[model samples]
Target: MIDLQQDDGLWTVTLNNPGKANALTGSMLEELLRIAEAAQEARALILTGAGRVFSAGADIEEARAGLTTSDLWERLSGTIADLPCLTVAALNGTLAGGANGMVLACDLRIAVPAAKIFYPVMKLGFLPQPSDPKRMAALIGPARTKLILMAGQKITAVEAYEFGLVDRVVDPENLLPTARDLVADRLVADPIVASGIARLCQ
Candidate 1:
């Protein structure tokens, strides 16, 4: 399940299936993609989770049904990456598997201290979505990216921050607030100017 909340030009998207660690299903991925596409007009967007784990990646049944290799993951991440707005992944907890793609695509990432980040494509016998590795390498560097994807090392939030995978490690209660604060300036600035700077930075 996904919940979307909008306040003026700010949008917050939350993954709500906590019973499964917010594990994503094919339909959930579709909804997330739709929301990201609709967020094009937003000044800022925050992507977060409702429980202790951001996502366990694809739901077990869905993954076994070919969700692991689906194109929707790439489409969703690409849509987020192309948004002309400040996008932040407010990771509430552990982040694993293909869920890394959307988080990697965000303009910034802030995770709770308890969070652990990993992608087990190697062990799962599937290559990550096409753009995920490139985006991940851009944030944390090629070797570090390899550590997670190739060697299947699960890194703590602090390690992720040190490797540049996550921009901040916050107390769980402050996660969403910190994400909003990060995008505050963009929300009030001239939209055109803010988006122009974002493009230039890219």
Candidate 2:
């Protein structure tokens, strides 16, 4: 499930499936992609989760039922990367599996101090998509990327910040406000100039 809240051009998306660690469903991905498509006039986007887990990644039950999200995964990440406004992944809790790709797509990643991030593809007997590994390599370097994808490392929030996977690690109480403040600062820059700068990173 996905819930969107908007105020003063900031859209905060809360993943609401705490019952399942917010495992991503196909419809959830579609909703996220919809928001990305419609955010041209917004100032920034903040993504978080409603309960204890940011996301457990793809819904295992759905996967067992023949659901596939590979293309949807690419579209959602690509759309976020291409968005004109700044994107912030407010990693409020544990993030795992395909969730790694979701956060990697954001322009900035800020996490609560207790949050954890990991990729379990190797353990699950699957290789990460070429794009996922490339994006991870770009964020934290190829060596660390291999450590995650090849070694299936489980990265704590502090470790993530230390290694460049996250830009800031704030207290749980301040995660949303911190993201808001950061976006406010980003807003001071000319939108066109900011857009151009973001394009260069693409």
Candidate 3:
């Protein structure tokens, strides 16, 4: 599930359903894509999760049940990357599996000190979608992305920051505040320029 809250031109999208580590159901992905598509009214957007995880990725039960009807990667990747506002991932906790694509699409990221980041798509008998490898390489460089994908390695928050996957690392309690501050800083710029910068870079 997902929760959306808007305040003062900021949109915060939180992944709920902590019991399954916020593993995304098809409907959840659809909802997220919808929100991403409609975030033009916000000056900035934050992606986070409830409880202890940003997300554990796609719901395995749904995957196994053959309920994965949509191409979540394309929908999410295009929506987030094309949004006309700054987007940040408040990586409040560990992120894994297909959810890595969501993080990749964000314009910036702030991870909790205890968070872990990894992509286990190969282990799930799937390959990283086209955008996944491209975005990962753009963020962390090809050599590091290759190492991560090839080794199927899970990196700590510190490592992720060092590799450039996360722009900042903070205590879990400070994650939201830090993200808000980043959004505030971006809002200081003219909206047209900010959107242009986001478009040019993404």
- The lDDT leader among the candidates is 1
* Residue pairs in collision within model 3: none
Please state every model's RMSD to the true fold in angstroms: 0.6, 1.6, 1.5
lDDT of 2 by residue, 125-188 (tens): 7766557898889888999988888888889999999999999999989998999988996667
User: What does candidate 1's lDDT look like per residue over 73-154, in tens digits?
Assistant: 9999999999999999999999999999999999999999999999999998999999999998988889999999999999
What's the candidate order when arranged by decreasing TM-score?
Answer: 1, 3, 2
Candidate 1 segments whose C-alpha is farther than 4 A from its true place: none
Error of 1 at 155 (Å): 0.6
The regions of model 3 sitting more than 4 angstroms off are: 67-69, 199-202
| Candidate 3 lDDT for residue 159 | 97
CA displacement after TM-score superposition, residue 20 of candidate 2 (Å): 1.1
Residue-level lDDT of model 3, residues 89-181, one tens digit each, is 999899987888888988899998889988876666777777889999988899898777878889999999999999999988899999999
TM-score of 1: 0.99
- TM per model? 0.99, 0.93, 0.94
Error of 3 at 146 (Å): 2.0
